[model samples]
Target: MTTLTPAFFAQFDQDRLTAADQAHYMHGYHVFDEHREQGALNIAAAEGAYIYDTAGNRYLDAVGGMWCTNIGLGREEMAQAIADQVRQLAYSNPFSDMANVTAIELCEKLASLAPGDLDHVFLTTGGSTAVDTAYRLIQFYQNSRGKPAKKHVIARHGAYHGSTYLTMSIGNKAADRAPEFDFLRDKIHHVSCPHPYRAPEGMSEADFLDFLVAEFEDKILSLGAERVAAFFAEPIMGSGGVIIPPRGYHKRMWEVCQLHDVLYVSDEVVTSFGRLGKFFASEELFGVQPDIITTAKGLTSGYLPLGACIFSERIWQVIGEPGKGRCFTHGFTYSGHPVSCASALKNIEIIERENLLAHVEDVGAYLEQRLQTLAGLPLVGDVRCQRLMACVEFVADKRSKALFPEALNIGEKIHRRAQAKGLLVRPIVHLNVMSPALTITHAQVDEIVETLRSCILETAAELQRSGQYAGH
Candidate 1:
């Protein structure tokens, strides 16, 4: 393990951080005061696939900093690019036909790389804003066609779009919506998730795919096709446990969307920029061309905040019509901030110049194979992987596939164990997820597998000792 010297802490004034200050800081997605005594993991620095905390402890970031840091951490080239852009032009307004050179160039590059008539780009601050933009655009397009009733959206269970009100409404995680966000828009409806592991017993994969498609079509019909605005989906569900869909599922769902005149929106916030070894997973991996695609995270490798909603020519023609008297009237102050655009341009150049996509294709397969070997463990119920994204689900009985009681917090226990062993993985309920940097190597893969192996073994032993597990 690599440790930083005391001199490193001097540069950042680490002496100022106290337990009282930490207690006052409210962290997102975590229970307040849950770790008040221990304090949060104060990340000080990072390089490549490894991160160092304030105590100089090194850890392998298997979750890729919330599944965004694709190229890797601490790339000097990316930093220089951002600095150079800020020195030149720090910010610019994207509205009123005003444009910046960097943003213009980035849009052109993205359009050239995108598939099938997806040429128009609308920039935003992050994934949630991109999704919010897409939803509004879908409604605008329908209203432009004099079909104001087509405002309802169709989303699948276990799918995560974003955190904004509209995006959160489209998301299907029941826990995310309960008493707190119960006031989210009701126009969003959810269909079944095409999760192979959760499929009913005696059902073949082909049958399951058909059933999921039917469920989607039935929901549209039940809602009345004229009232449905769009269908939003992730190529692979991310925060909802990395659920990979059955084969040919997305294409069939696209066909249903076409039949019902519902726009298909692909949420590639976590899967784009080589996560699936492709610039965009919609056409390259899923074999479907969506009407709109919302992307963030990997666009700049999480070095800077940036998001974009790419539109198909078919939708653009209506919104871009010259006869329209009113403006779109929606934008963010940081919408095409030149610094973020510059960083994204440099990030893409590095990914292309390094041929990281090819690297991921080769290394990702090894990761999947190594993770699959854990299925022999008594607590490993299922291991699913596609490219660099993966999930390991824990259960009480492997044969019966019964999950441990929620109170056990099996995933969190495994996560803590792995972190102690110099590895970090995201715990989503009963699953441990991995979406490491695209630059991770075979040797690093070995470290991850070994650490995960030990963590699972320790967790199983703890459970058995506490009478929570009854396995050999």
Candidate 2:
């Protein structure tokens, strides 16, 4: 993990590149010692639904470039759009009232696509900043409206907001809120995850829904209606093991938030831009309109860094009142970077041109159906999916819903095997996740399922032989 280099850097040599990566390239949350000898996976090139390593091995990218590549990869038109924008107007100051053409255009496009009166957009570098900005905007809104006491925020257990201090503080994930790292402990609260699969064994789905709604209302009242500002949630929790909430969960939670004057902030970083067969999932899929929607990832299809904190007209009337001489006093150097905005504009155009939204509805269903086949496997505890996004939870005992020991690194093992067998999946704890490009074909879906099946079976056999997994 040395950050110092002695001599001149070599860019072309593979071994030299690996050495440089080990010496200085710092990646997030990676086990440095574990990959100290072998180095990292060197991604060299990417095409539609596939990525190639430095050594030229190809993988059907099942994780969609970390759940962002909705339009797939290596689109020449996307490249042309980016290049054209760069050549036309590469950079501009998004400070104060100054703006660029692409930035203005992208905002208008996003406003049109987003549901409800989410007409105002605050652009950011990525999802993390979008969320961070949204919270700050909430703070501004609360303070301006003369309710400074309504500062505390409510997020759910097992939520992933961002790596920023405030976002991490509110997010209850263990790694984000680790003991060593500092987080705002007092400003955040958590409710139970709305996971139907992990709900009380005897509780029916309807009862579970009622219980969640009651619990959410109870959390708000317990915090005091005047003290809570907002409830932050993902439509389907993405990083917390792709936990899809119970039916009617989003609408009910929004209702409760509405009753208590708490704003609903939907974190649709992974769900927006065609991951769930909709441009946005909150209103269209779940029937709830959030006050603030934090979005990124698929915004530019992972091509350029871009994200937005889209706010409703109701919020704008308070904080954006022109007559009041209001100053929101928040922004970034690359808040509305012209090149990034141009890329996003092109990405949306491509999605429309290809009719990715309709295609996702058709193919996403097929993917969910195909993944159901994995439930028959012994290692699988649950096969949960929300349209194209999916996860396979590993288990030691199927009937009892027992998890395998963490030491086994079961998800990583399966991920490595699947990658070798020509598909890539995301490994989060004991869960193997998939979120392929929206352009993925039926054949690609079949390839993913079959490769995963073989990989899981092989992994099980190897674990059994090593006495790590008991067949009984």
Candidate 3:
């Protein structure tokens, strides 16, 4: 009913975005309409470690946009690389003997960078596809080797592999899976999470590792080791609230897997591509080389969607059978998109040329040290972190190690408060997770920590007055 003036249209367009986006889009990992009702924080632009909303308000992005924007938002080099590729050849189907030069080069570069002889690469669109490919590859290898009964896979508790039915089924977090898509439940079994906070009291690191290994052995034995295909894990669990397992836990677990002749696959989707102060978190952190590694996110630095399932010669040779329709019989239409591969190659070049991995090692240590100071706070129970990724768990009583009830929404309060103060944070359960870009400066680290500290005080008072502070 209103006249369509230019100024009016601008404001109307901005205001109408909230309603329009809410009505059509069913956002991922979000409660959709419910969160939409709360008003989405629509990002307009971003650069370095900061993002500006449509309202022109700027915020320091600590969570790195679902933990994917590792190289930070809006890098000119990445943008140009994507543009150049789009001009030359934007799309290609790497199927039926057809391939793209960018894709081939990316595979070679990734092979050179990957730990050990993870020489072969099977590219995919994203993390879920990479995980699914790895699963299929495992099956293919086992079947080729005449282990027809080897169908079950072992996944660690509190891990997030992907959202696809198979990956979701094996993921440690059961809540991520849709209620109806529980078909793969029987094919996957979960082992104890290596997180120390959830670890039972009076258990040493040695005992914990032994307990987990024993559980893995028990589960495999119960299912018959011959039926077990592979053991899947994240070097450090990400969406499972940033849990870092005990030292040597993976080594011992790998030993058990080897004893059972089970293949090991590391889901380095979030932990690879130098995000964890190393090219691969599994080999760098746990000192265990996986037979297969699924990686994404930083592969293209989220500039373009690209993921890969890299495998050692053992698994590769078994699956690379010739003729008679012996192929793996799995692939996506956009499996090796030229543009995505171009972006990934350039991104990796930036990481290597800039020495970003070594920077993460130094800055990550500094961050861990600084972040640990939050532990002494009355509301903070423990700070679990390693190298650029961190989480602060809120407890009702630090001494007793009791968490605040979910109803309190302490993490949400802290997150919102931090966002208001120009710092972005994500809340999961009773913890605040920060996964800032690896390129963050020391000053930026200090600023992030300072803002978070202020947010805690502000949230505490607000929650206390509202009778939501669960601290007794």
Question: TM-score for all predictions?
Answer: 0.97, 0.96, 0.95
Choose the strongest candidate by lDDT. 1
Tens digit of per-residue lDDT, candidate 3, span 340-420: 999888888888889999999998888898888777766887898788889998877766788777777778878888888
Ranking by TM-score: 1, 2, 3
lDDT of 1 by residue, 27-84 (tens): 7665555566666778888999999877678899999998999999888788889989
Show model 2 residue runs off by greater than 4 Å: 1-12
The residue pairs in collision within model 2 are: none
Q: Give residue 228's lDDT in candidate 3 (0 to 100).
A: 92
Task: Give per-model CA RMSD.
Answer: 1.9, 4.2, 3.7
Q: What is the C-alpha lDDT of each candidate?
A: 0.90, 0.89, 0.84
Pairs with backbone N, CA or C atoms under 3 Å apart (clashes), candidate 1: none
